[model samples]
Target: MRNTRSVRTHEPSFHQSALMDLRRGGKFAAVFLVLVFGAMGLFLVAALVIAKQSIPDRPAIASPPAEGVGSAPPSGSAAAATGQDHRREQLVRFLTAAAHPGQPAWRTWMPAKADTSSAFVYTPLSPADPGAREAGPGATARVRPSALTPAQTASMLEAVTRRGSVRPSSVAVSHASGRASGWTLDFVVRTSGGNWLEGRAAGSDRASGETVLSQLTYRR
Candidate 1:
């Protein structure tokens, strides 16, 4: 009797080997593409960080006012007040010198160095009587050194005797209107008779912004 069981033979075929190789190649290509995309993403992130660090901060500028509106600049009143105060102090010094008999007090009221040709006008009055003649340029150079008359000398001496030393604390300064640019200084001194001697000094601080004495008058 013939054997009815059939025996299977094992063998490698080119078609099956080619199919297995193709599957392995496809898996490797997928892995390589994934790695390439991941590296590209990392490089992009790094480049963005470097660019951010290279930029510098900038300062903010103020915006200008709208059209037709104006921005207020710094006021000159403060500077004017300061200049007036300084001039007041100078006038006080002049008054102090005038209290003496022979000192050229008129010179003190003038600028240390005058740069202008404007004539200075100085007028000295007496406390004894209003009829006393005013002394200054064109009338008499009594404001100069050794130019005081016997009566004027006596009047100054009597005033000093009646009034104590000048008090710079009582000096005051005011602005003069109707002039282009000028100021008025008011001076006060305490008297032994408990009275107050008043003096007014008016002048133009003009001539390239130089302080000068143009007019000075004193009364009791």
Candidate 2:
């Protein structure tokens, strides 16, 4: 009987030990789950911070202020200066066309409001000493067909045809004057040939200037 009693007591102790081990395992599993979730939360927070840092700041656009409440109008002199600039630009276009004979119809070089009736006063340079002649009085003569001739066009392209030929290097208004009749401009066209063509342009109206090719002169 004593032996049987001892066996029962040992069996109950064994069962109690098993239950203790299972409780310890459950506690360990709960701790492991808590650690994994904490690491994931930290990783997610770091990713959000990195994303914010990677984004670039955009530049702010500037908007123009509304006109007229306190804005001052352009001065009279400024307006006149603008008009002169426009006339000079037109003269430069003509000089450029005169230098390169190809593209942009030769006649388009003339001002929109040119007076064709008024003949161009062209003066040819003496062939003997083409570069020696000066701008002199009585050197000019009125020609009926004011349009540029084939020979003149060839001469305009001379710089383009010579050694190291390039299109017109530069065009500038050498002289300009406003008169009762209209505005007169003298343009200097420099070419790749290292030579320049002197052209004279005149406008029909003085108030609202409208210039045209009145003269074209150059050295051979």
Residue 15, model 1: Cα distance from true site in angstroms: 99
Cα distance off (Å), candidate 1, residue 87: 1.4
Q: Which residue window of length 10 is worst by lDDT in model 1?
A: 136-145
Q: For candidate 2, which ten residues in a row score worst on lDDT?
A: 126-135
**Model 2 TM-score on a 0 to 1 scale:** 0.42
* True-vs-predicted CA distance for residue 121, candidate 1, Å: 6.4
TM-score: model 1 vs. ground truth: 0.40
Per-residue lDDT tens digits of candidate 1, residues 23-131? 9999999999999999999999999999999988688888987885665653677556666666777666655665664555544445444334444344333434212
- What would the TM-scores of all predictions be? 0.40, 0.42
RMSD of each: 13.7, 8.7
Q: State model 2's lDDT.
A: 0.56
